[model samples]
Target: MYYNTNILKSTDGESICYYRWQANPDVPFKGIVQIAHGLGEHAGRYNHIAHLLQEEGYSVYANDHRAHGKTAEIKRLFGYYDGKEYFDDCIADMYALTNLMRAENPNSKFILFGHSMGSLLSRKYVIKYGKELDALILSGTASFIKVLGTIGLVTASTVKTFKGRERGNAFLKDFFFGEFNKKFKPNRTKLDWISTDEAQVDLFEKDPYRTEDFSLGVFLDIIKNSKKVNSPEAFKATPKELPILMFSGDKDPVGEMGKGVTRVAKQYEKYGISDFTFKLYKGGRHEMLNEINAEAVEQEIISWLNQRI
Candidate 1:
């Protein structure tokens, strides 16, 4: 069964869009997985993944962060230019939803599954609220801002201070999509998981839930919050015993700065954080979960969840 609802988060005055799926409500659930999607995408995109998990006896819940999808604010998506507000809002929204789920389905364990920027938020949340979950899975993860901290800070500040509300497209090209453009002949709309499915790309292009461009303020906020995750202080604050699984594609541009998903795992390991595992798909790209071999990626996630929970 699948259900959709709006969760009102009082802290930020944001009504987060939440989706729930369960195969058997009567049968005791193994646990619940709260999925946090990456930037520019909405929680609904993971319905297929949620269906698979529901079939495996785990209920699934997902929410669109403040700025993305149905939760967009007038000024900006999450926060105008300060990214920490977005992270804080995301954590609060997750906390509220988790408590709501616990109330709805008592006595069940809980896990967190976050992708891309969502993974970053998940990590920060775990550090602050590690006791809330049984395990965590981070996909297409990175510490980009950590690696390019100074540069990102300068760029974001310059963009926001000068450009204000005027939308800018150069940043996306220069930062996120540059490598892909270099490797392949740049196609403006060929942005969906490197697939030949024209229909998929077309749907994504027309999806009202998707955000093609971000504000300069939000861009800077991503960098600032990312830097927090990269610091030694952040690692030390993280609960060492919490089981974590992180993975990314070796060919992912996010890994270009040497701070990809594997790098994130190594950082935790360096801080004596055990019970963490990292994997890299040889030919995979940023959106591994949506890639050609998505089944393999999904299977890996299921297998890991089986061991941990």
Candidate 2:
């Protein structure tokens, strides 16, 4: 399957770049998959997953959010997006791409798949836009502690005051993610928590786009939005009828080694979510889709989607 790189003008007048993998014309189209990639990564990295989905009759769309990947390169907004409501703006950008996807495939179901930071955004997205989605899949997701999030936000806010929002702050970055590497002792790389597959970790380390340090504003927005999504109100706002699937690696520090994912699932239950499921891949790290058993992980997603669609 071939993908076309396209551009969409965002609500704020920023050009959002995305890759669209069209489903097979011969087979009956099943659904549309919109992928929200993790922080510091581009939409093109998901091409392998897109190809698999395209073969399975699912058209895939993954966009580079503002200040990340191709969108950042094109706009020269490398670290931080303009404006205060960063989280809301990111969600809006995703929605814009989603609108385009739905327009092209009106008859198909819509599945939102988000990874890592994207997973956090997707959690918030379902709260506001759950009615529009047929299903939601969250990978490397966590149920962030409100108190910790508050502290992080406060620190980031303070730092943003001293250091410009667009400029990266090493202290803040280390304060949050520095411990991720510690979990993997004899750490060959700083991002060993990303995947056990050394090749994938190397690809990430070598990629200029992925290696760029995000600004303090990015951290602030993430914590702020994470707090919002995990709130009681956000839980109440989520459409109970929306089917949700949360998956993470047992060894993924982002999910607190699966504990945080379980907490999220429990929270969903507490909120009266009618349909919800979660899975933890044994010995898997943060990016299970890029893990050693990635093929199996991919199959799990395909099978789950097949059952639902």
The number of the candidate with the highest lDDT is 2
Candidate models: Cα lDDT each: 0.73, 0.85
Candidate 2 per-residue lDDT over residues 144-243, each given as its tens digit: 7555566787888887788767778787677666667788998898889899999999998898777346777788888877777877898899899988
Give lDDT: candidate 2, residue 84: 73
Error of 1 at 151 (Å): 3.1
Whole-model alpha-carbon lDDT for candidate 1: 0.73
Clash list (residue pairs), candidate 1: 67-77, 81-217, 83-221
Give lDDT: candidate 2, residue 83.
Answer: 66
Residue 78 deviation, candidate 2, in Å?
2.0
Model 2 residue 84 CA deviation (Å) reads 1.0
Pairs of residues clashing in candidate 2: none
lDDT of 1 at 161: 64
**Superposition error at 308 for model 1 (Å):** 1.7
Model 1 Cα lDDT, one tens digit per residue, 1-309: 365656556456656778788745555468989998888788988888888888788988888776677666434453223344557767888888888878877878889999888888898888888877789888877775444556767776776666663345466435754444354455656463433344556776687777756656556666778888877888888888888888887766665423456667778899886788888877776777777678898999989898888
